[model samples]
Target chain A: MNSYYEASARERLRLLLDPGTFHEFLPPSERVASPHLLQLDTPAAFDDGIIVGKGLLDGRAVLAAAQEGGFMGGAVGEVHGAKLVGLLERARDERPAAVLLLVESGGVRLHEANAGLIGVSEIMRAVLALRSAGVPVIVLDGGQFGCFGGMGIVARLCDAIVMSEEGRLGLSGPEVIETTCGVEEFDSRDRALVWRTVGGKHRYLLGEADALVADDAAAFRQAAIDLLDTKPDLSLEALTAEHERLGGRLERFGACRDALDIWSALGIAAPEKLPLLEADAFRAAVAGKRA
Target chain B: MEKLIYEFDGGAPVKATQGPAIVGVVGSGNLEVLVEPENLGGRCVVEILTAARGFGDIWKAVLEDFFARHKLADLRISINDVGATPAVVSLRLDQAVESFLGGAS
Candidate 1:
């Protein structure tokens, strides 16, 4: 697949596993239909929008799932979302060592009415349930489509998130934000601001990102390995502390304009220079410097 | 053309697979696909129920090629397309494997 995310997924597996070790289930063969799209006279994909599976890492069991950006920008439909929630619940029951997700989504599919939204929430519930059950979920964000809407919340729920410069995490897209919050608040046309606001670079700097790596699939694998090895099991106090810190962070953005303002607030003298830096350099520059 | 079902193998039978599971945007340039495990026999049923019906042959050819390339089994696939590319279709197939079989390389 020439698309960056497809390459990323394939590369992620190659770097994470030995050759010929990975297996694909329910592939395109399972003619899973979208209950919503049929009403709109749309074509339905076999797996809907999300893919869930089980794989192994170092002989340890790991539950896996990836978003199909190729299919409707990997949007969530009823069947697709149900499948995700079901598999996640299964993972919780089975208690895999970990669950790894490669997210490339645009959030809920409105065509399916509330079903899609419910599915997203179900997935979130499953994630939180897994967390509550002492299992870990690691979210990987590095697709061109990015994760948006309900998915943004899902990204936040994970135990840890590893992102790429290509990854984006936000509740709303720039255009939607512009439509709702007006262009003054968010210029939908500005790519730089979008990146600065919710892009992986900014998230990494803000401590929302546990790790930031290149788009290289192998790099993602190495990073995932490094992350799985040292998973942070935060206590409720730590979680609260992080939440308090995050609340303050979001408030600071309330009165801010350019993303540079955010960087400046984070104590970077040349905030403008950070965007041009690689993921590692930017990560190093902002290490322990977030508000 | 068979109804087969299976759960996740819980591992990657092969190395890394690539691509998107859904295509086309909710809008014009957007689309979504779900990539997960159907874990059936090697024969995957690619069911395409699209508003674009004449594309049945196109759908068949695509699935045939995808099944041949990936060798997915016990898998059932459903696609909701607003018009994606061959590029997108292939990616979604890869993603289905990735999502279905968590964390395969």
Candidate 2:
């Protein structure tokens, strides 16, 4: 009954991991808070708003991390960013069974601009390194904060992604789009439009997300456990297929404005009803149509 | 570029067991403290880098109180402060000390 979108970083980790098996690294008690935030007179959390640790998922060893969105929009500062890098590096060394990232971030912290940017790049490199080592990095983006900016790119680079219908995944945020392209192009206040453009359902249909699950923590955790059984092929052939898929998206939806066009093109009857359908019903409808 | 450096002497010698310990963050109204074991001739050295200038007396008072209460010795404490209150500074120092003494991993 617990919603993943509303859960705290610790709560989400507990729900994802097996019962009472999570071991934290550099926990809040270690007080590895950001040194950059102090110079800017901003309140900082002891763990730098990101919890990196290890746990068991269905009795399998897994490395996991979660972002605290309530703390400064879950922006990545120096220590926060370093923790992510360190986790991935550890994953490379330890070679865990899997790596799960419960991402809810707006990307870099503006307070530590340069350092945050560099940190994100370092994390991206680490992720690639882990992926190259055949370690599956899965992302579950179901939090209310969603994932945007550089984190979006990072999510895309991951092996697989499981997101809720309410979860959004995009490189640029709605506000940024509205400000840069004008309200006529993108009205940030239009919730429906925003969701249509970046929500989990849309990303799934676009082939950006691997799976779309319900908003509950149990649903997400189940989906993650299921994914662990199947290792995705990261070969060049798969990469080429993904490239074609992305290219096809641009060619198909290049001039499309209304999301209805997309739904209709995908052969969904009565595209208007798709948004209001429940998660299970929607999945069924999409499956039937695809079949 | 307003930086303040002060060193205090005549404090009870610390056990100096750990390498270094850090606590807190540098954010708005926050700061980070780094404590390292050093042989400073029984003196506790303090270095502060702060954007909020013209508070030397307040900084001195806060650090003095912390040093007096803890009686720490042979330690080099560096602070990167924004505008954190005396209470926060004190708490960070305590946290650093506890962490340095193998309190938490």
Candidate 3:
């Protein structure tokens, strides 16, 4: 398991940014601690496992946050949540051209109890607020900590999403799904099947990902930059048309047992090939031909 | 192996008769309780399920501890846990119950 941050930060944005352009705010020096972990007999990191700040890429005013997978699996707690809220609220006030959240979370921090839930809810509010302010909120799920639980909903709500072959996005974790639906519905032990069902490729084909890119940050940044140009706004006519289309899609999947069934319905030709291809090749291969 | 169900009235007929009004997340190391209004003959019923077994007396002691401190009723609260301390759990349960019972709308 390579450091996702290292692999991503290096390949993705390390070269994309001009020298000295990315400025980190509320750095470890600020010592923002997780108010919840103190009681859990655990040590809290300086940024509560998230790296947040303001940075410039091609002179684009970007505010961002990334999970520090090294610390407690990069879970969100009260302070972590508040800091993100504060950052997004500040971004809204400033009306940045774009906001990218490098989400690498296990969703709400259960250790913190209700505080983490409130934190997630507050972040959701801030994301919606950003959209209402007409700022593009972009989410990149490029690796292992794949967004889950409430963050899955958050990603779905984002104006745009960029994913990698390694990226995963879903409301319930495989374990939860298996628990709720039994092995027949899903087998959490089957890693490849899990990836095939919820991996970025599957999501991209589903029209959930605006663009898919390589695991490296450079590729993801380029993809992210490309997607920033598109916005999601619904017209009444379009909404009705969409409902009609989705009605057809839903009907296509009546009583469908697995994502593979949906995949096959979409005519992937070879759904099994999804998880193996590199992010770029896969996206190129499946461009259009899907919703 | 023992059980205790605590009750209180936050000084009035508060919360819904039934239907959930949830707030909070249950992430690793934390838990949140959702309190909703339900008319089971008009009294708040608290049901708790926790992974930390063998603490029934302590659980009762804490809820008893909380109910004795506040006035709350007309709501049913269910708590889901992933290993949180008593203090955080209590605070959230109180807040959820308070929110459900209706306050500053």
Candidate 4:
């Protein structure tokens, strides 16, 4: 309740949903752990680090999935990916009011290698399918691991994304960038630089995330409830508008070195004060400044 | 990785409400325990697949202490460990049993 950022994946879903409404599918007793982990001599979690099931969100039927970031960085393995795909595919038939995806993964599991990559691709397609079918797929990003890699792309494909200030959404994580591009390119140890670049505030300002809330489960729950009726437009005109909006953002701020520069370009007065502001105040101040 | 199994003569069968009660997460220096009611005939079985090898004796001592504290019967306790300390293992075991008896939380 205090912090969704620190709660376990199961704890997050339990707190986010109506009390005692959650019913897990392929529970740990099913022993559906990754076979690749076993082959690689790695410890395998019983549920493959993902908890997927049906639950009532404010008395409406919903399918949800929570990724255990503590286990293997919540990386998508064969089984984990399959579970998500199965849930999304189920939504096509169940036609739940909405599908909540509590994302906390750091992309594909390296232990599973190619299988992990293929699994993420399958999940991406499934998310698109669900969205095309008019099912509201919402992402709650408040986990410590921060959604990145393939999972970040999957988050973008969803109908809506709600994030907490403690949450981060990006393609390549700081460590990954520092490893691939030299330390000079990105100092992963600089926590301030990391947050300013990919933190929830930055994503929200860039119009990458739909809403920003506090790092508490109740805030996320409220935000999800508010957006339950939202159905993203998938028509050709809407897609073209989105494409043009992204292109215009790139053309306007592509040369900016930091978030502050982008914020300044958006005519935000005193952009440095953004992080210090509280969630509600921040939302008010950045009303029309977002990309 | 090492696989260890321990079975003990227990007291009464667990009166859990539904399916298995799972606790903990398989992170570095952490582990997950799955407690499921089974027809073990007054026995509790623990199966561990640990990333840290050569700690079988330590695991046995810890699990022994756990079974002594909670004399749960007809339970299938499975653990997937990633070099978790004995204290963490005991904590997860206790949490698992507590959830098993009180229903999944």
State each model's CA lDDT, in order.
0.69, 0.83, 0.68, 0.91
Cα lDDT tens digits for candidate 2, A111-150: 9978888999999999998988888999999987789878
Top-lDDT candidate index: 4
The residue-by-residue lDDT of candidate 1 on A117-149, one tens digit each, is 988888988888877878788888989888898
Calculate each model's fnat, 2 decimals.
0.37, 0.10, 0.00, 1.00
**Best candidate (score: TM-score):** 4
What ordering of candidates by TM-score runs from best to worst? 4, 2, 1, 3
Query: Please, what are the lDDT tens digits per residue for candidate 1 over residues B48-101?
Result: 434433555565666667666666555555554555566676776666566555
In angstroms, the error of model 2 at A281 is 0.7
CA shift of A282, model 4, Å: 1.9
- Candidate 2: deviation at residue A47, Å? 0.8
Query: Each model's TM-score, in the order given?
Result: 0.74, 0.74, 0.68, 0.97
lDDT of 4 by residue, A157-272 (tens): 99899998889899999999999999998898988778878999999998889999988899999999999998867899989999999999989999999889998998999999
What DockQ score does model 1 reach against the true complex?
0.20
Real contacts retained, model 3: 0.00
Q: In candidate 2, list every pair of residues with a backbone clash.
A: A37-B26, A37-B27, A38-B26, A38-B27, A41-B27, A41-B28, A41-B29, A42-B27, A42-B28, A42-B29
